[model samples]
Target: MRRNGNSDRLSPIRVYEWMPVEALNTLLKQLEKEKRSLENQVKYSALRLEQESKDYHKTSRERCTYLAERSQVSGSYQVSKRQQMDQLPRMKENLVKTGRCNSVNQKTMNAMRGPVKKISRSNHLPKLNL
Candidate 1:
């Protein structure tokens, strides 16, 4: 009995049985090769991602340390007396009259112009004749 052209309606089992055994084996080998190749690509990408993540973390840590050191260097200079001040201009003026605000800068003249005392031992201690 000759069937009409309806090969697309064949069942999966019928389709496999219709193909030659050597053709099926060749297809299987090709599919396995593709699977191995894909697996190797996946491994390569994973390793690369891990290496990049490590580098990112290391750079982040180094950046944080560098910023901290820089802040320490700049913070060493006292810009203000404290976090807050209790008095206004009136109190500040009184403090200046009492010689309390001598450390604060209100004049344009240099503060380091004060006389520099000699650092020799004679100025520190009384000269005792041995």
Candidate 2:
């Protein structure tokens, strides 16, 4: 046999008559306390999320700054290296002109060797019989 839904369900007045006032009051207070606790948890969770977002953004900015500085340093080093490489041919030409790699120039050789002193030669008269 199918049960009647209306007969199975208790009306508000019947429920109130069955449950004592003290029990209903206690249940209401417990529910209110739980609601307040849940609200506080929600607020704490929101604040924690906001703080984590701020920390994430701060670290991201710091990382970007570090990468930019590293790239600039690397770029500067590359430029300096390129400049030195570009001067290679000119340095070779200078070496060739200075005769350091080929026949040496007397002036340049003398300047590189420092000052030279000349010794005076004096002949003393000595007769030897052959």
Candidate 3:
């Protein structure tokens, strides 16, 4: 019963018959190794990101504190300067009328002496309190 080359005949090999349990186990182990490696990389990246975030927050907080302090100091300085400017004309008038130097006018005349004197005078009680 020799068939022609064009005749339809079933092959002897079965598709599912090649399944080996050892080969399947090895493939699963390889997949697990890859998953573990990927997980480690993700963990490392997350840790680095967290550390960077903490550092950024710390730096931002320090900057905010510094700016706040600077603003406070500048505001005080501007207020003191404005007060001195307002009193300058009156002090000059007093000096012209009195012809003798007074303590208040002396302090006003030396307004640019230093911040220490200003701060000390600000904290001290006036002569009226004595």
Q: If scored against the real structure, what TM-score would every candidate get?
A: 0.49, 0.58, 0.50
lDDT of 2 by residue, 4-88 (tens): 8885685655776789899989989999999999999999999999999999999999999999999999999999999999998
Residue 62, model 2: Cα distance from true site in angstroms:
1.8
User: Could you tell me which residue pairs clash in candidate 1?
Assistant: none
Off by over 4 Å in 3: 1-19, 91-130
When summed lDDT is taken over every stretch of 10 residues in candidate 3, the lowest stretch is 8-17
Q: Is candidate 1 or candidate 2 better by TM-score?
A: 2
Candidate number with greatest TM-score: 2
Best by lDDT: 2
1-130 per-residue lDDT for model 3 (tens digits): 8766554343323332475878767878999999999999999999999999999999999999999999999999999999999999899789767965546645556565642244555558656654
Candidate order by lDDT, decreasing, is 2, 3, 1
Q: lDDT (CA) for every model shown?
A: 0.77, 0.83, 0.79
- Candidate 1 has its poorest 10 consecutive residues by lDDT at 77-86
